[model samples]
Target: MPAFAIAAEDPATPDIAALIGQHLAEMHACSPACKVHAMPAARLAQTDVTFYAARVDGALAAVGALKALDATAGEIKSMRAADEWRGTGAGPAILAHILREARARGYRWVGLETGRHPVFGPAQRLYAAHGFRECAPFAGYVSDDFSLCMGLPLA
Candidate 1:
């Protein structure tokens, strides 16, 4: 098996649902309630978003989505790595996969929104390691104390 493998998956899969639920709950818990921007399973299933589930050694490792923002860019939403898989690089693997997908689809950039809480420090580090640098809000999000955005240009 490869060091990291990813595949397209149904956003509504029961396993994916549980991961996303936990992600949303954690986001809401650590930040102002209205600042949580996690996408629900239903919304993740929309045509504009391509969702993925990743596994390692046959165990569910994580889930994420690449949401099309326009012809030239996409937003990564709902990134969640199962607690058991954190620090094991599963989430970053999914992020690398999302970037590959963006490149394949001719997107010049990929961006994401995460929390500003201390609890999110690791997440910030992960994105930074992948070349996702902080940027102004790109989609519907805005500048706020609790919300931060990052973008990586593919080309």
Candidate 2:
């Protein structure tokens, strides 16, 4: 297994964009009917947010984002780990990094939306294991049977 490094970068960076594209492709390929909608790479690259990518031996292994919602709030978005690296702790490490970054940026709360499908079970567990608790939807999202919302308070 390759060692991984997680860090932030501009979404527009060529390598970052490619990594995001690859991550999105892997997610879609794994779950074509994914309850959580996959944002197009172009749209993701245009967002004003902190994006982190996991690199193994200088190759992208995963990518995720922390979007600032307000002075004390942030939202997790587009988290994806390469299929080859899924069971190698890449996901959790990337998530932990995002949480740390959120706290560092003065965010009092961080939340995420994910599918409630079986394929998402691991992700839900990952979040729960990291101290995130199930919560009502935020950021204009309405209740949906196929979706789950989770949050963690930093304070």
Candidate 3:
């Protein structure tokens, strides 16, 4: 397995931009237009969000972000593993990094919204493996048929 190095980066950079564009495209394709909530590169670069990129041998492997929702909570956003790196450790590595960062920042909980469609099964399992449990809508989100929200409380 290739080793992944996860680090904070600007999502608007050339390579990262292309990856995020692909991520957005896939999200839109698999979910209804109204249910697709993947953020564009510009939004991922917002002051309240910290974006990260995972690389293997200096090549981009995946991307993920943590957005501050409040003084004690955060939301995971824009998690996408490059097609070539899927099934590798890229996804989990980047996820662990985000969780670690959340803890270091003293967050009480981290939540994420993902599609409830079968296409998102793997992602749902990934989050579950990391101790995320099904939860109600958070951070202004409302209960919806197309969205599944999960949360992991930091102890």
Candidate 4:
């Protein structure tokens, strides 16, 4: 497979929307709670925020977003990699790229909420490997059995 490139762009872009659709589909396919807990795709696509995607051979392989929560903090949202691309380092690559962009934009800390179920083990491992540690919920999210909160300092 070709090397992947992560690009920072508007999620409103058509290509980005397609990638988001694929991401949401994969997440929902893996776990129904993804759709239950996730913000609607249409709403996410319309948000004005920093969005990133990993592209391989000009096709989107993974996508994520960093929404500014405050001057010093940002929230990781809509993180997903295509099923075929999972376990290929694409998710971590996309995450690292998102963090770099977050730091460049002046965020001191990045936070994220992901599913806590056994089905999400790989995702949890990916976040851990990238230096994200468990943390209390940030933003307006409530603690829930189906969710886990994680954070990392921007270097």
Candidate 5:
């Protein structure tokens, strides 16, 4: 089996597409109609967005992306871990890898939007542990009761 690795690889791969679709579906199911902010695979394929897949033993375990909101800021988008890999380190590993990528790209800040539903508690905690604090609406986001926005400022 190949060692676990993350790369800006093919988001068109079936496994990656299925995982991202599940993520968007769950978001739409949990949040109100206007608050469903998950991006589609086609949007993530744009030049400003860098999509990554975490692979374990050659199987796709998780997927995420960093979308340049502007020159100094980037947003974490479409972050989802496959069901079988939830409890594994795949989520955090992918998150950490993306943050490093954001920093390398000269972003002074990183932000994300996640559902406020109870089901998202673990995800909220994961971002909090990595220094992303609850913050106001950013970029094109508007304040909504069902959404929680978080941001971390880099040195």
Candidate 6:
């Protein structure tokens, strides 16, 4: 297994920005234009969002972000594992980090909007393994055939 570490990161950094570009491209490829909710690097840098990066053996491997919806809820966004690290635990590491941050902030629950296509199967399974369940959309998201909304309650 690859050794990995996840930490808060500046989304606008060149390497991070490049990865986000790839993430956005993939989201667009699999979902309709209006249903692609992945945020751009500039948006991830906003104060309400906390972006994270995972590095495996000292090389960037994945990225994820948490956006505060309110004091009681947070939204997970922009999760992506580099092609080379997709099954190397990099995605899980960043996801765990984001959840820890949510708990530390006293959030009651966390949720996310993901695509409903076969290409998103792995991501859906990842969320499920971490205890997320399908739920009504949150934080201004609308119910749609192309979107899968999931949530996990924090104690």
Worst 10 residues of 2 by lDDT: 30-39
Evaluated with lDDT, which candidate comes out highest? Answer: 3
Q: After superposition, how far is residue 153 of candidate 4 from its true place, in Å?
A: 2.0
Segments in model 3 whose C-alpha atoms lie over 4 Å from true places: none
- Please give, for residues 36-118, the per-residue lDDT of candidate 4 as tens digits: 45554456655556677788887777888777888888888888887778778788888888888788889889988888668
Cα-based lDDT for every prediction: 0.88, 0.79, 0.93, 0.76, 0.88, 0.92
What TM-score, computed on C-alpha atoms, does each candidate reach? Answer: 0.95, 0.83, 0.97, 0.82, 0.95, 0.97
Per residue, candidate 5 scores C-alpha lDDT tens digits across 1-155 of 23459999767788888888888889878888788888888888989999999998788888999999999999999888899888888889999999999989899999999888987899999999999999999887875678889999987
* Residue ranges of candidate 4 with Cα displaced over 4 Å: 10-19, 22-35, 46-48
Q: Which runs in model 1 stand beyond 4 Å of their true positions?
A: none
Writing each residue's lDDT as its tens digit, candidate 3 over 2-74 gives 7888899999989899999998888888888888888999999999999999998889999999999999999
Q: Write the per-residue lDDT of candidate 2 for residues 1-155, one digit (tens) a residue.
A: 45678887666677667667775665566554545455555666555577788888877677888888998999988888877778888888889899889989899999998876577788899999999998998987644777778999997
lDDT for model 5, please: 0.88
Tell me the deviation in Å of residue 66 in model 1. Answer: 0.2
Candidate 1, residues 11-79, lDDT tens digits: the string is 788888888888888888898878988999999999999999899766789888999999999999988
Model 2 misplaced stretches (Cα beyond 4 Å): 10-35
User: What ranges in model 6 sit over 4 Å off?
Assistant: none
Model 6 lDDT, residue 92, Cα = 86
Better of 3 and 5 by lDDT: 3
Weakest 10 consecutive residues, lDDT, candidate 1?
A: 1-10
